[model samples]
Target chain A: MRPLRRLVLAIPALWLFAFFLAPFALVAKISVSRPLVAQPPYEPVFSLADGWQGLWDKLSRLTLDAYALVFSDDLYLDAYLSSLRLAAIATLLTLLIGFPLAHAMTRAPRQWRTALVLLAIAPFWTSFLIRIYAWIMILKDEGLLNHALLSLGLIHAPLSIFATEAAVLIGIVYSYLPFMVLPLYTALEKQDPALLEAAADLGATPLRAFWRITCPLAWPGIFAGLLLVFIPAVGEFVIPDLLGGSDTLMIGRSLWNEFFENRDWPAASAVAIVLLAILIVPLVLHERQQVKERAA
Target chain B: MKRGLQPFHLAVLALGFGFLYVPIALLVLYSFNASRLVTVWGGFSTHWYEALLGNEALLASAFVSLRVALVSSVLATILGTMAAFALVRFGRFSGRTLFAGALYAPLVMPEVIIGLSLLLLFVGLGIDRGFWTIVAGHTTLGLCFVTVVVQARLATFDRSLEEAAMDLGATPLATFRAVTLPLIAPAMLAGCLLAFTLSLDDFVIASFTSGPGSTTLPMRIYAQVRLGVTPEVNAISTLLIGFVGFILLGAAAINRLRKPQGSG
Candidate 1:
């Protein structure tokens, strides 16, 4: 039993260490290395055959120029800022929309609640790229939205929504709405209705009861939903790339350009490292919160 | 206790569902349009769907995605089940915090960082980036999800059944195989399906990890979508949506079937 348990533990631990944790170390190492024109596109490459001394030599030769450049360049800075701003706005928008939807789901007839929840989650099972692509067909200049508006005489010309930040926001909110709604629904569904009834008995208005009782009870879900939406939205590549125009500067797109188009592995790694650094705290805190919740 | 959905709440639900479903409905509608221009309707036709059948590039990439999803989801399920057991059953162990962290981090880690980092690892190890590397990256990504699902099931699992089997003179292995496996089978199946869909739907990780010849369907779709929208793309997108919808419905039906038995 002891040996079997040990084996069970070791297999996944080793796999994650090799594939998940070790890669971060590699990214950190390559971030400080210089870009080369050769294959693999980075220099001061470490080889295991060279042993510790060679590793030490490679380590010593690693430069901070990539980091310096990431900090000094306005492109990287703007991309990072834009990503944060867009992600924050998107998160707020999802919460505004998701909260009411979740509330509605919980308020639904008891038998209908499960079906409603499933309906909310149905979009998530579809291919994310397809969902985003569906938006492109709707939001484009000559798309259905404009055609509908034009026929109604509400607008003289088509709205230029596609390839704009507005399009990206819509794409993000649409794609991730399920993520935000699920958590909020789960949290809301678990609440005791008696509390609201009790508040009403005490002469509390619906709005006041919602603020005092519902909002506080929904805090964990709100936090979880915010992190779920905002974190991924910040590094969202497809939504921004496909929906936002060339003027949209996102760190994820910039990172792709650096590695794929520019062939600058060091610079891309630097960008990744910085992005990771920014996100690690919230990620760790979220994980810790999850652990605590599970344990409790 | 008598409170029900108000008109305001009903309105929100209507708008919310509309926001979610309208685009999908439009995509399906446009796929049937005979027009070369996707937005313009030129009588209903199935020509685009027929065109999709002959597109070798799209079909090849889809085959690649299917193979990757099949293999990687299996790999993720195995690793994830083990990790879930370790976390839930093993309790306190050395490096348990780290183990939990590593297991859950991928859930929220940005895809770009995950992709870039894994690519660097493969390059550093002198391994060629291709189908297998995408499998590895996806397996890593998918396992975290599997762990979360399986862990939720494991947390709520009843251990007394296993203890009863052991008291009846069954070995621990036999008890686990007989009692635990059957009980958790639904959750495991759910985890595998989740992993499979995640791998199938992935674009970013697959993009960074794939080599010249290993383009997945999403990669292919992304490339074509970048150039311009086509009715053919809509046809394929509608097909994928339909396929995934079928799977989710089937899963839901299975869940409904299992619930009565569990409660009984």
Candidate 2:
């Protein structure tokens, strides 16, 4: 019994330890290192030839320059702030769009439920890169959207909203709408028909019933969906990079540029560490929500 | 029960579905466009599809992405199923909390942090960053999802059936094989499908972990899109989307077939 249990325990533990936990420790280690012109582009923690002298030298040379650089620069700061602003607004928009759709799915006939669920998840199977790419096609000048609006007589000229913050918002909302709806639908689906009926019977209007009954009942889903959208959206790189113009300053893009374009490993690691640090709060809350769901 | 679904809810859902699908529809529609300009609708042609056959880089990347998705998803499913089993069946062992913590952490960790950290780990360990590294990276990201899905399925399972198998003189492993594995096969497949698509669609992590020769489909698409929109991208994307759609349909059909097996 014990050996079998031990074998069961060892596999996942070793894998996570080697792959997940160790990598994070390396990230933390590299964030404090100095960037150099050498291969790998970061100074080693120590050299074995110098023995204790090298250890002391490494300790002395491990400066917080990367941390200082990120703090000193307004580009990273603005990126963080803008990412937060964008993620927050996008989360709200996802909720507004997802709630009704999810509610409708819950209320849908049983046979149609599968179809609705498939419809919801169908796009997720497709390439995310492509979905965002599709938006570029739609929103570009002389694109389908502008052509339609032009023909519809909605406006005299094409609205050049592409490459703007609004486009980024659209991309985020479009991409993450499913995340919001799936959880919300799951929570809303578990609602008792009796509860809503009782509220309606007790002189509550439909809107009032939804507010008092459905909203409160679906709080867990709302919270789950919010965290799901917000955390990823905050660190979202692809959407803002592809859809956004030069005016947009998002941290994920900045991190990419810092690493790839600048080849500054330490600086990029510091940016990532700080991004993780700021995002740690919601990440924990999300874990807590998952635990609660599992427990329930 | 007087269940009244508001007209507003139905409309909103319709709009949401429209919003979700129209871009995809447009991409499919334009993949056949005779015009080089993505926006202009030329008469239908199969030229872009022909063009895709000649692009070696895109073809190679697509092949690499498929291989990586297949390998990583199979690996992730096994590992994640083990993690799920441990969480569900192992019962209050030491470091269980830590195990649970590690299991859930990747689900929410930002791709940049995950990607950057793992890349650094590879460089630090002197491991080559290419196909295998991507498989490792994807498994790390995807295992959590599989664990979650399998764990949910396990939570609803009937433990007494396993007991019944045990009572029939079957060993624990046998019981699991005969009883548990069959019961949870659908969910496990679903989890694997999830992992596969995740690996298929992953751009950020693959970008960070992948070295020169292992460009995936997303990486290729990203590079192409960066150069600006082209009908070739539309054609390729349309094909990829069609492939995924087929997978989903197969899964749904399999699920429908499984229901009768479960009942009988």
Q: For every model shown, what is its TM-score relative to the native structure?
A: 0.97, 0.97
Residues A1-296, candidate 2: write the lDDT tens digits.
48877887788788898888888888888889999988879986455677887788787878799999999999889999999999999899999989989988887778888889888977777778999999999998778899889999998999887899999999999999888989999999899888978887888997899898889999999999999999999988999999999989899999999999999999999998899899989988988888778867
- Ten-residue stretch with the least lDDT total in model 2 chain B: B1-10
Off by over 4 Å in 2: A47-50, B258-262
> Per-residue lDDT for B58 in model 1?
96
Best by lDDT: 1
Over the stretch A1-296, how does candidate 1's per-residue lDDT look in tens digits? 49999999999999999999999999998999999999878898777787988888888899999999999999999999999999999999999999999999999999999889889988877889989999888888998889889999999999999999999999999989999999999999999999999999999998999999999999999999998888888999999999999999899999999999999999999999999889888887788877886676
Residue-level lDDT of model 2, residues B1-264, one tens digit each, is 356566766787788899999999999999999999877778999999999999999999999999999999999998899899888888888888788888898887778888998899889978889999999999987889999999999998889999999999999889888899999888889989999999999999999999989999999999999999899999999888888879878987988988987789
TM-score of chain B of each: 0.95, 0.96
Q: Specify the highest-DockQ model's number.
A: 1
Q: Residue A2 lDDT in model 2?
A: 85
* Share of native interface contacts present in candidate 1: 0.86
